[model samples]
Target: MSNKLFCEGRWTEAIAQYQKLLEIQLGDADIYYNLSYCYRQLNLLDEYFQALQQAIKLYPQEGKLHFSLIIDLRRNGRIQEAILNAENAAKCLPNDYTFKILKYLTVPSIYENQEEINFYRQRFIQGLQNLIQQTYLKTKEEQQSALAGIGRLTNFYLSYQAQNDIDLQRQYAKLVHEIMAANYPQWVVSLSMPKLQPNQKIRIGYASHYLHSYSGTLWLTGWLRYCDRQNFEIYCYYTGNEPDPVTQQFQNYSDIFHHIPYNLSAVCEQIIADKLHILVFPEIGMDAQTMQMAGLRLAPLQCVAWGHPVTTGLPTIDYFLSSELMEAENAQEHYSEKLIRLPNIGVSYPKPYIPPVVKTRSDFGLEDDAVIYLCCQAPSKYLPQYDFIFAEIACRLPEAKFVFLRGTLLEPRLKRAFAAVGLNSEDYCVLLNIPERLDYLMINLLSDVYLDTFTWSGGNTTLEAIACNLPIVTCPGEFMRGRHSDSFLKMLGVTDTIAENETEYIEIAVKLGLDLAWRRTIAERMSQNHDRLFDDKACVEGLESFYKEVCSKHFSA
Candidate 1:
């Protein structure tokens, strides 16, 4: 009965039955895995972790369990724990070098310096090359499984190190493609696209694991919201996400909605059968399943967008759909795929609605009169090199208090970095609980200025702040990932906050902190012009044209 419930995707009901079964048969490792899988589907992270531990203890040699645990660790930014497990997995699965590569792929969340980051990156690159060069006697199926395990999350941490990762990213992509080719040679060479039948709309497939409500994925929906459904038949492959309202909206938009969470081969076969004209990965490197799928040629023409904002180095990806504003003139060099710069900010992102809330600064334990700079990017993005910005800003404005989302593991690192510069971080920095969606908007509403991270800029967070009429102070960095706010501000025609150098960034921030009139002026400008960002039909129209053009070119006579 538990198995039946599980088969039907009734995760909650199945979990209850599994628990009862487990109470009687604690020795069954497979049952423990099922319980853990059910808990994970429900997003009960701690419960899932515990159940996985029990399952692994019962059967330590199982490759799937180890990979599952490692994937979970990688997802939660538990770098040290993931590395430890990768090391263990490498020891256990000596024949499969994927875990050994995975150990290097996961870097330190908080780097001590450039040298430390370089060390990890070099090792990761070397590991990928080694995998490509070495021989494995493992069967094609086993090799395919290993590739999926490693591809669960690509080298996402490397982008935060503020360097061009094209070589390294492409190297990994080459390795992934090599394995994929070995397993499925037919997909290695692109299949000719089927001709479009009379009265038929283009069959477009969009695949990703983040089709639900998440901040990182918010921009992805903009394309779908305004799509020309009459001209395009959208087929969405949701690769395992807890269904939310956002997921429901995607279902409403899709002609065919498929939720294939496990069984990589089955998903690939299903995609092949769909015979899509164009396949789009809204974001890759975030989900293992999506990453694994991107390595294969299920579609004649495949593309990736800046939803995750890093170039997917896979040779199978035909294009990188980006924005004219976000990418530099030479941006083509950054990606393996052909660069297609869409108009404005590219995606027709709807202006977020931040309802009027009367939450005062004191409600969040913030001083009512202090200059609250929301430095709320994940703790990992706050590099040691940029930690001085907080201290420098605080020195000029004594009442300056930077608000950061609480991260227990890496929060102390930021605090220590502040101490090294002779600043008492507690006085200048407030590590607070990450609030609910509306409350996060309220935090933006309450804050004086939005402090953008130097290397990795905020995407949706910047948009939300703009929606709140908040003034953003950003210094555009070297890469496209670092220039998100630069694009937003340029599109909004508010370039006053964009800084060219560290000195100017601090100066601009200081001026914003001191001059209330100036802040009010910038807020007024945003209020007048911010509406331009939302509900764009032009980008959608452009997307439709792109679809028709690509299909026309690829379709067989």
Candidate 2:
């Protein structure tokens, strides 16, 4: 009965049954696991943690219990505890991929300190080499498990490296992909045309984990509202818990709004049942659940756009939504997805909430005279090139300081990265983790100049800064993160601010820093241009045309 309730998605009922079983002294590891699973399903974090802890305590030797607890702890921000549990779990199940993955998470990084970070980095490399050696020495099943374990470790390291180095991240990704393909040959595939009906209404399904309270939802709103209700139907598949006010208001516009939690196979099955002609993935590789769901070919035409600007590197994704400015013909071959160029910029937007500049230099521990070269992009977006460029800018402008808005969780790492660049911890750097969106806007307004990141461009951040009347100096690269600022800058008529290389990037930053009148003029012009770039009516028109063309092509074919 508990299993039935769980299967039917009545997680509360399932928990009640599990609790009853526990009270009768029929409690077992499986019952405890079920109770924990039910709590996770309900997103009751505390309850899930408690139940998982009890399960692990009751069955200390149970490898799966330890592994589950490790995941729970990591998700709940108890990384140090997760490391300890993972170590215990690994001792019990030496070959378990889950435990191995968790163990990698515990490995300290170079950001911890030069000595410790370097030690762990070398250890990680040695551990990976040993795992590969063991895979070659073990049975076929063991090799597969070992390869998967190595892949997880590769991903964890890649996450940390990606913040500072793009090339290293790419190299790591390539190595992991090759290893996985060698073990699981059927997992990766070269791009191929998708099989589909020649004539049908193009069914465009937008999939996102943040179909609530995020830029993805905001950009998609006008498009959904103006979709031709008769010829083309929009299906929104959401994987998040908090349904924002916009989400509630926009549901009436979509043909269907799926609020189910992320179950990749289940989501795929639902998409197949709906027989979507064109599946649009709005959120890129940010959510593992969405990525897993996307790997399944539920729709004939699967396209990716927005949310994450980077190429997903997944073979299942068919097309990438881009504009002529972002993707030239030469650049298309580099990406994993086929390039589909929209007539205008691929994304549309609504006017942003431009909060007044209320933050003073005193709030961030800075002087009013300091020329602030602020990077409003999250610490994760701070690539090594960005660090070099910003540091160079600071070096050139003695009076300029770098202010970074680090996430609460990323403050320590951000500080370490800055310190590595020879900047004093408090002399030139200030870290503010603002929880309120309005406060964030106010903070952006405080900066004299905004510096953009490469690999993953500042989408919302760039827009918000422009809305706050700040001059943003950017350089468009070959990929999504590289080109985002270019697209926005072009739309806003700020082409003069786009730089070509490191020299040019620094030159532009220095020029902006020195010329206060020019900065004020550009900021004023950008503020006026923000309306044109983020105009809801213009965006809706472009979206309607794109939808009609997609439907026409599908129907005609």
Best by lDDT: 1
lDDT of each: 0.81, 0.67
lDDT of 2 by residue, 157-234 (tens): 233333233333334344444544555454344323233444544467887778777875577776776666666778
lDDT of 1 by residue, 154-206 (tens): 66677777788888888877777777777767777777887778888888899
Candidate 2: where are CA atoms >4 Å away? 1-91, 94-96, 100-201, 263-266, 363-365, 385-388, 407-425, 536-557
Give each model a TM-score. Answer: 0.86, 0.70
Error of 1 at 216 (Å): 3.7
Q: CA RMSD for every model? A: 4.8, 8.1
- Model 2 residue pairs with clashes: 164-384, 457-481, 477-482
- lDDT, candidate 1, at 453: 88
